[model samples]
Target chain A: MSIKLTYFDLRGRAEVIRYLLKYGGIEFQDVRITIVPWGNLKSTVPFGQLPIYEEHGKVSNQTIAITRYLAKKIKLAGNNNWEDLELDALVDTTSDLLEKVVNFYHERDTERREQLKRMVLAETIPFYLSRFEAIAEKNFGFLAFGRLTWADFFFTTTIDMLDAMTGMNVLKNYPHLQGVVSNVTDLAVIKEWREKDKSSVVLANDAK
Target chain B: MSIKLTYFDLRGRAEVIRYLLKYGGIEFQDVRITIVPWGNLKSTVPFGQLPIYEEHGKVSNQTIAITRYLAKKIKLAGNNNWEDLELDALVDTTSDLLEKVVNFYHERDTERREQLKRMVLAETIPFYLSRFEAIAEKNFGFLAFGRLTWADFFFTTTIDMLDAMTGMNVLKNYPHLQGVVSNVTDLAVIKEWREKDKSSVVLANDAK
Candidate 1:
């Protein structure tokens, strides 16, 4: 059976997994829910959350988990030994920041929103971006060396997610992160697959 | 070379990895930081965060990542295939909630603190703990089937952390979670480990 990814058509959480599949040249049945139809589909998800993954009759929830599972299936995790685990953990760090950003978007008011964004830009974004940049500089391209691990895609997705949501140029401050984002997006398979579906739910900030 | 774990010598983020080491019975240099001494260590960690794992001469940062790395090392992930991924994701979910609790503690002032705690008690804690209880119930003891995955330890750690920090008895409402917490703590290794280094860092509500 083909892997089935269920989420709202928007790239809210499922985008990274979708991007990972395309980047790795893995085919999945991407099931998108129309905003109009999400109400009916709401209860179908475990924990009433989207971005559920079903493969070969097994089901799992949580975006990071699903993305990692897909990365595992596509062999995009890492080479061997503890590398896969490292890649998985690195990808999770992006999810960690994304959760913070999501909260900033929804929970913070206008007065605090700018402060929150600034906090992330100053603390969160720089920390991870600089680290990823250092990793890229060390490996000369890959985040974990020699191979494109889930961490690479996750980093790019996080940058993209932030860009899409906030209308802010998160990577402009760090050209290296932009380079990594560009590399992941410009992958031949990803380019081909993404063009076929313009509805990949680019966040509002990503529009730039 | 021996494994090195770097954090603030507190159980906040590094404890899970430390627990995994003890649970798996792996010997490694704890590398406790007697003082944060951020001036010296700040530049070394990715995202300026802690619980970095150095194995095979490569270093990785992020507590969850370190935990998964150690989980893989100890073969505590699960039986085979997707079980491990699902387990890790579930653990991630519980950690996600715990992070919110931390953030809640950090963000709220004294005036709104109790209100915020009530919000968590009503929403975040119950939402995750109840689901965890359900997962454990279905699995007949563990969060994942027939094995103790990282989720089990993560949940137990959450209880321990919350109990130490809030004194709110977060687990009292959830019988199953309390039972699981009780059972995990009862393990000889964990019990012994706790006895050895029970002087952990606790963030009092007034710490800020």
Candidate 2:
């Protein structure tokens, strides 16, 4: 099957899907659109959104949806229906955190943005991360079911983007979250992919 | 298995789960908490959020997570992985519409709220509904795979809430979307449940 993943060149929503593909040793075309060309390309896609995955010419949008599909294919999904529910819940919760962080990034007012950033760094991150840490602690450094699931991958990838955007060390105090990041990146495939993909470095430079 | 669904008395997020259970012939406890008592019960839940589904003794949070779980159990999920991806994408798209409507409802400034509501009714609704209409038109009035899936159910239930919250007739121009709503509510179980559930009447009144 010819597979292609399309999104902006930035390491935004598409990063998790890319990580999943790489970690699973799945081969796919990575189509990245620059901001200048996104306008011309936006309406051509389903729902006028990016991070779309096309397999055999059939396209699907929505970040988590794509991730979930790839996760299931790569055996990153849970063992049962209930376990999948737990994974979904955790993934959505982490997405909520990312949404708040994105809002802070997009806020135009400097003072308000700073205040929002402070709140995100202080209250919001801890509120969600502490709970995630607890879950990972129980699940042996994995986010769900005591093993690798897409939730861990989702959390690790998006949290890295959050850290890049905010210039904040999010996992400094949360050992289990740090463990999740390490566990995902420690995979041989992911480690090799990171060596070749400079998207993280680009994101860090953009934040600066 | 004993099932209990807890959320606010309003049909905001929990209504989808309620509809799924009723449609699937599954029995569950409908635990509705009013705003007054919510403060006392907030921290007791898993993530301090509502629309939690509890089976036997274990509890899970996140509205879509709960809905997706029930969908799988009741055969409302897609027949295969690719079809499931389509369902997830469509469900998430409808959710994006609901989120914007929610923002309008929560906006404090009258002028700003009016502007947001206008955008929601005009650009936002059409942008999403038109695409959905096209999808439904192709799939025999169903949102995904030409049959009843949870995406159809999610769109049906949440679109009603959006209509209620915004006091707008979202599906007036989209015959296919109207067909989806009718298809879901036309189910014997849902029809019977709606007759007894005063929440719909309450929402109708609120829209007035």
Candidate 3:
């Protein structure tokens, strides 16, 4: 099936799907649009949003939905129904953290942005990271089960994005999260893709 | 398995899960905590969030995650992997609408609240509802596939909540969405539950 992912040039929402497709050895056209043209392009898409996945000419939006679809196809989803539920919960939790960090990134007001940054760095990040750290510790470094699931991929990508946005190694204090990052990035396909993908490479360098 | 759902007395986030469990003939303890005592109960829960579903002593949070778990157990999810993806995408879209409406409901500033309410009523509601109405029309009155799935249940309960919050019959202009509500409420199990559940009855009355 011909697949094409359309989103902005940044790794904002489509990064995890890109990583999952690469890790699963799937090939697709990565169409990155810039901000200037997004206005013209917005009305044509479903939900008028980005990171849309078009498979066999059928388009679908929503980042989590697209990611879950690809994850299930790649066997990155859990083994059974219950396991999938667990993985879904973790992915949603990671999304909660992502929203907070993204809000901090996009805030225009200097005072409010500082307040958001402080909340994220002090309360939000630690609150979520500590829970995730405990979960990873229990599951042998994977986020959901004892094996790699889509939640790990989602967490890994979000952590990279968070670090890039905040210019802080947010995972440095959380060893379990660090392990998750290493576990996901250590995949051969992801490493290869990161090396070649300009957006991922730039994000990696920015985080460092 | 013994099931217990803990949330505030209101149907803010847990209502969809409640509706799904009821529709599935799954009996659960509806544990409602008011705001006054929530401060004391906050730190004990995972992520310190509401609508935590406890099953046989295991606890899980994230409303969509919990609802999806129960929906699968009751055979309310889609028939196949692709269908599940469609359902997930629809659920996420409904969640997007829920966020906007809830923002308007909770806004304290009168001028800001008025602006948010206008946006929700004018742009957000129509944007999402028109898409959903078209989908329902194509699916023979159901949301995702041509059968009753969890997305339908989620959409039904959320529409009810939106109506209650906005004090408007949100489904009035969208006949397809109204058809969806009728299709779900026509289920014998849901009808029986609504008749007996005071919270559901109150919401229905408020919407009326």
Candidate 4:
């Protein structure tokens, strides 16, 4: 394929790219590696990381960077520079949330992990989701601006992973945040994409 | 001040914004909060974080996002959307390196911290730096494009904090990366900005 995105099987990092491609109706190869020993792929890719986007064999790493490029190409980018900045900031805010969720899950010690779970569910999640809910309300259910942008696509794509990590519906208390998620999922194209033979290794919770 | 950037006194995250403003010949307020208990200021900002950019009374956060907005305003952005993707990817790569250094530095257990330091010096830093060096060489001393894009500005600004965290000359072996650093720092405006009445709490090694 001339256009490709290669990543791991689950929705750890590459889901945003996949969601956007579906949302934008772009035809490209979505190559998810389910194997453990990513031997040659690890050494061949830049920074030895996945979620690499290739256009006509030219590759670029960095998940958000790839998504922003796709967003701009699909006309999902902001209307102006300021709007883009707001979107970028909002996307990074979700990234911050993702980082906390990652740390909470990756802690190996049982006691520390439980402690982290409490802190994340009680404080960190609320800190971010509350502010995001307010922003969504202000933006008319959109995350950044009072219109559809790539940030919505990015956030909804990430929420599934957050839901799995937090072991609860992290969006339970935030109605507007739920709207942000539905706004993207309710689109006919996205609904159709999820219905198709997405892949053999689609994350268990991603179906909804 | 009509335009402002507020962050901690150290040249940690906000240095890119300052350097970009200087390079772009934009004049604005540079507010460095040196004291502890940044109680009121902390509560007032979005995300309760520093390194926020403000124009008049409006504010925005996220270091890369703020710098990107300024990059567009100052013409430091790429010639096209693809180029912006490249720049953004490069900047985020530096951010990844910064994350490693941050995790290394923040490990409180002495034995673990030393282990991390060794791993970082031996493996992690080399893995990223070698790739960055090749990229800089290919791009003619710039990180992304063979032009003075914001990625160069972002990397050079971030090198100071990396230098402090690693506690050694991390770029000593990478001539191209060093050139990338000098390409931004050697600019007359940047040189002058460093020489003027710099902030009181400037990090000890930053004077060089």
Residue B127's lDDT in candidate 3: 96
lDDT of 3 by residue, A165-204 (tens): 8888998888987888889999998888778877641233
By DockQ, the better pick of 2 and 3 is 2
DockQ of each: 0.59, 0.81, 0.71, 0.78
Write candidate 1's Cα lDDT for A85-202 as tens digits: 6676667777777877776676435777788877876787667667667767776566776567777777876776787766778777666666667678788877776678666444
Please state the error at residue A71 of candidate 1 in Å. Answer: 1.8
Q: Model 1's DockQ?
A: 0.59
Per-residue alpha-carbon lDDT of candidate 4 for residues A1-208, written as tens digits (9 for 90 to 100) = 5889898776668878988888778889988776556676698888998889999878899999999999999988988888888889989989988888777787766887899899999899899888889899999999876788899988987787788777689898899999999999899988887787355333443342
Instruction: Write the residue-wise lDDT of candidate 4 on B7-61 in tens digits.
Output: 8776778888989888888888988775565676776677787788888687899
- CAPRI docking class of candidate 2: high
Residue A172 C-alpha lDDT in model 1: 76
TM-score for chain A in each prediction: 0.85, 0.94, 0.93, 0.92
| True-vs-predicted CA distance for residue B182, candidate 4, Å | 0.8
| Lowest-sum lDDT 10-residue window in model 4 chain B | B199-208
Cα-based TM-score, every candidate: 0.90, 0.94, 0.92, 0.93
For model 3, how does the per-residue alpha-carbon lDDT over B1-208 read when each residue is reduced to its tens digit?
Answer: 5999998777667888988888777888999887678899988988888879888888888999989888888899878767788889999999989877886777566887798899999999999999889889998889977888899888988887888878899889889888888899898988886777666312233232
Report, to 2 decimal places, the DockQ of model 2. 0.81
Give the lowest summed-lDDT range of ten residues in model 2 chain B.
B199-208
The sequence of per-residue lDDT tens digits that candidate 2 reaches over residues B109-165 is 688779888898889888989998999999899987788889988898888787787
Give the clashing residue pairs of candidate 3, or none.
none
Q: Model 1 lDDT vs. the true structure?
A: 0.73
